[model samples]
Target: MAADEGLTGSSRVTVFAMFGVAFGYATHHLDARRVGDVAVVGPLTPGVEWGLLWQMARNCGRATAGEAELARWVLTQATRAFVCGSGRIAQFPEQGWKLEPGGKRVRFDSTYANRDQLWTGNLTVEGLAPDQVAQRPTIYTV
Candidate 1:
């Protein structure tokens, strides 16, 4: 996952999409600033590892109780709330996210942590394969 604002790492976009704007609100609910140009790449089916997602969510619950609480609240409010305050218009054009023709891999440095919370790093997650319908993900860190 990458954003025009900067780079962070996670494959939560698919699950996050379910919450729509509420997901953004849940993610940045404590911050006054908004996000911009967020993008993610991963398989939707055949490769989307749902088990991994569930494990991640479970791990999140165990590691960050406060965040889990906020996520729960946001999920419950997703249908009725219009969470329009958490994101801003992207400064870069959509075309800037494209890769060369027939390209199938991308490389970037991003944060990673184990589900057990024993290790973490800003290691390069190289050669990621974007799904057929997804755009190339970009990682920009300051």
Candidate 2:
């Protein structure tokens, strides 16, 4: 009985050690490359997302009310970040970008406005000001 108990314990320890090694190797193999201008879309930290959303909201009513100006700015900044790989808006100046809520959709350009309702988390914007927008927050979709 004593010898049998020792064998069982040794087997359990060996299994655990093997599992640990496999987990470590899998993590190392599944590493992802860093993206420049894209907000990671997944379950994000609330504090970070809220902070970015608040800053954008504050700037929403600055030029006009009932206008999707905030949405437009968010999209533009996000696009720029994705394209340039810099994640820095200062590098790309805003060229009279405006966004209007088209029913459920937010339009991007001034002409030929493409209307598509924005599903929260599907698309998001961050960085509205020099100080506010620079703090990139993780975004998640429902």
Per residue, candidate 2 scores C-alpha lDDT tens digits across 1-142 of 0011100000000000110110000000112442111111111222233224325544643555443565554444434433453333233222111111211233334521122222113111222233422223335221
Quote each prediction's TM-score: 0.21, 0.31
CA deviation > 4 Å runs, candidate 2:
1-43, 49-51, 88-115, 121-142
Across 15-127, the per-residue lDDT of candidate 1 in tens digits comes to 12221110211121113443421222211222232223223334545455443342342233321222231222111111112111221111213321111111111111222
lDDT of 2 at 34: 21
lDDT (Cα) of model 1: 0.24
Model 1, C-alpha of 25: deviation from truth (Å): 15
After TM-score superposition, the amount by which residue 42's alpha carbon in candidate 1 deviates from its true location, in angstroms, is: 12
- Where model 1 places Cα greater than 4 Å from the true spot, the runs are 1-46, 63-142
Against the correct fold, how does model 2 do in TM-score?
Answer: 0.31
